[model samples]
Target: MSDLSRTPLYDLHVELGAKMVPFAGYEMPVQYKLGVMKEHLHTRDKAGLFDVSHMGQVIVTGTDYAAAAAALETLIPVNIAGLGENRQRYGLFTTPEGGISDDLMLTNRGDHVFLVVNAACKEADIAHLKTLEPAVTVTPITDRALIALQGPASEEVLAALDPKAADMAFMDVATLTLDGAECWVSRSGYTGEDGYEISVPEAAAEALARKLLAHDAVEPIGLGARDSLRLEAGLCLYGHDIDTETTPAEAALSWAIQTVRRIGGAREGGFPGDETILAQLETGAGKTRVGLRPEGRAPMREGVPLFAAEEGGDPIGQITSGGFGPSVEGPVAMGYLPTELTAEGTTVFGELRGRRVPVTVTALPFVPARFKRKPAKVQQA
Candidate 1:
């Protein structure tokens, strides 16, 4: 812990009585005084503030926006060139074999592209982005802190500070001033709720966090609760649910790939492993990621081997992410199963403590998402 890097809000977390732990090479709070369960429920009902500065933030620029977008499209399997201004899209970096290198969020910020990538893979991701160097300039933003305010009450909480926040739709990015500091905000989050992810200057990060916490609906949430919330939402954790060996098609993330990058589309086959991925799109993969519900009270944690029958058979697949979903009030998990066994309601068995336990395949997102996809309607005067 002594050598681990700390975020700008590390001291604030200590003051709030957080249990600090090492995560992604950083000493971060895993839970506060309220604990994981309470913190998890609080975020679903109200708002929770998360210090996510450990993630990488980078800006890619070129002669113009199109040049930068085109350079980026060569690596990611997304239609970056068609991304609208102030809008964001989820994308992935694919390997030559069609496996996912990393998943990220990219925003088309007028003059340049803003990217937020996984914390643990930032170094490699940055190095990978440098390949687009001659065509685009890669600038790593190290002087900023990233924070997320997430929950059903997030909109009202942020709107109280700046009314303009209420007008932004889901996935919309904007530059807003809060507490007299310039902040880049995006109307999105990982908790399956309406929220905002803000990137603010290092000097102003603590002040902004404190201000947001002062609100009655906002609480200081830690990594433990963050994990549970995202698991319940059926979202993938970079290293767990997705990794270098997993292809986007097998991970059930084909939705993130726009048609333009697929076969028979105008701008197809430009990214790495385009042939492999495009073929997967036309012909499904052998195994696919699916939501799992372990029967009864016990949780089927990660790495648990999956079996097709209760006795005398080799493992079929393995659980990638699992936990007690606070919002769902039961144990939930996600893993890769054979495409033949991926149908909804199909039954499978998890080898829990050497005994096969009944588990059922189900649709993802144990809890429904509550994103504010559209702006609130206004009444005529």
Candidate 2:
């Protein structure tokens, strides 16, 4: 703890018997006394509270909406200009070579754009955004602490705190007062469950956490369960599933680029890696990210090289993310492979502990997502 930074709730975590570990230069809780497996199950069954203050939250503002959107669009491939008020969109920061610099969430708040970037890449992200300079102002919200409440019961627990939270749909964001704290609540989470991410003032974070934890449906969760939950949902884990060398096309995240940002669309593509990314979009990439399901219960850990069906041939790719899915009740993993071998049911093998373990190309989101999308409003007669 000498050099590692800690969140506002660090002392509360210690009081709860949290096992702290070094992650992204912060002393974060990886698991509680209940262990990772149980915490994973609890999140699926009830609700789990997570301290995500290590993530970066910033407000990007300018004199006008177009200027702010265009400034941000220059770095990412998303259609920032077309994002509706209070709507959230996912985008990737691409390098000039078309590789990913980082992944982020962008929310259009009418007057300004709100960004949430991965903790490990936050500093670099800020520096990169600062290149916009006088065109747009990038202000980091250091006084806030972010928390994620996820699971089926998350809505109920949050609704009890602020009934307005129940009206929000997936990716919807609003300013709400929860337990007397003015928080920025979003109906979005890394887990594939219905939930909310609340950003509150640092001083109010502990009291808010304690209030939620006291609820019968909520339990404290750590980074361990958070990783497993996101993995099961097929979500990328920044440095692992994506990195400076992996482009959006290779990472199976092309959908993050809206139609307006694609070739021949309104905005057309003026992003960092538009040329390379657009070319890959049209011609397809050499290796595509895919889900892998092992034939046995053996977990196919990351860095395990994957081989094609034929006995003797060059290795196509390697597993980027792998772990046992508590919901799937088996081993699940993801890796990249050639376009021809990306078809579902394509057989592939991985060398684990000096043995060739068989696996098959499978679709992602081993567990189904339960996001709450608002029903379409009926037109008045």
lDDT of 1 at 318: 98
Model 2 agreement with the true structure over 70-109: per-residue lDDT tens digits: 9999999998988889989888999999999999999999
C-alpha lDDT values of all predictions: 0.94, 0.92
Task: Work out the TM-score per prediction.
Answer: 0.98, 0.98
lDDT of 1 by residue, 1-381 (tens): 899999999999999999999999999999999999999999999999999999999999999999999999999999988999999999999999898989999999989999999999999999999999888999999999999999989989888888888999899999998877899999998888889999999999999999999999999999999999999999999989998888899999999999888998889979989888899989999999999999988999999999999898899999999989988889999999999999999999999987999999989889999988865689899
Clashes of each: 0, 0
Give per-model CA RMSD: 2.5, 1.4
Top lDDT hit: 1
After superposing candidate 2 on the true structure, give the runs of residues whose Cα lies further than 4 Å from its correct spot. 376-381
